[model samples]
Target: MRAIKKVKKFIERSPNSTEGITFAKLILALESENEFPVIELYQLNSDEFDLAIELLKDWRIDCFYVGKAKAFDSATRAKNLS
Candidate 1:
């Protein structure tokens, strides 16, 4: 529940960001517990409460990681830096 509270704080601070909107949708899906697919799409958006708050406070809040992609050249995948 503490984590959920942190998530709420992040949303409150950046209510207009694309990430924030997606996160809001994810929370709705989670609360309904009947929209797993929608929730799945935003699973990666979840952030640690503390870190999420910091990102918001600093105004650098597009804080979710994108999925890794296959490397075009060598067979290695690109590492996620988020």
Candidate 2:
């Protein structure tokens, strides 16, 4: 469970990344359910955030899958936290 939280935090804030403010907005969108164009409740590896944009790819709970753009966009700075 701890590892999962870490993933979320990294997605929430990649402090070591160089993506800038766009990264932050992506974080907000990931955490937010209805605030952004996407809604991702599962955690993903930092590197995979940009390329893994599949429906029901890594979900912990089963629900309607509506895959959108990967990581909200390439502009989102996502750094590996592990």
Candidate 3:
């Protein structure tokens, strides 16, 4: 959950940033049966970009299931709503 918390904090610190929005969407994709474009990450600064890659790596290796499960549940709910 640390990585997810860090990413949430990063988004909170710069809610209006393109990187924030992009990361938010990327997280959503990670949580669901969806895919995000790798090219979009090129828009981020090094730190943000690294975090995005870290998220992917963590998710790929199934390192954070509980948090990802919660995120996926939330995404499923929102998708069902709209």
Best by lDDT: 3
- Top candidate on TM-score is 3
> What C-alpha lDDT values do all the predictions have?
0.50, 0.41, 0.83
Model 1, range 22-75, lDDT digits (tens) per residue?
557656754464453434344444354344444344332222221222233223
TM-score, model 1 to reference: 0.42
Collision count for each candidate, in order? 0, 0, 0
Residue 20, model 1: Cα distance from true site in angstroms: 0.9
- Candidate 2 residue-wise lDDT, 1-82, digit = tens: 3333444565567655543333445545554643643333224445545433321233312222333344444335454432
lDDT of 3 at 25: 90
TM-score of each: 0.42, 0.24, 0.66
lDDT of 3: 0.83
Model 3 / residue 71 / CA error / Å: 20
Q: Ten-residue segment with the worst summed lDDT in candidate 2?
A: 55-64
Candidate ranking under lDDT, highest first, comes to 3, 1, 2
Instruction: Write down the TM-score for model 2.
Output: 0.24
Error of 1 at 52 (Å): 9.5
Error of 1 at 46 (Å): 8.9
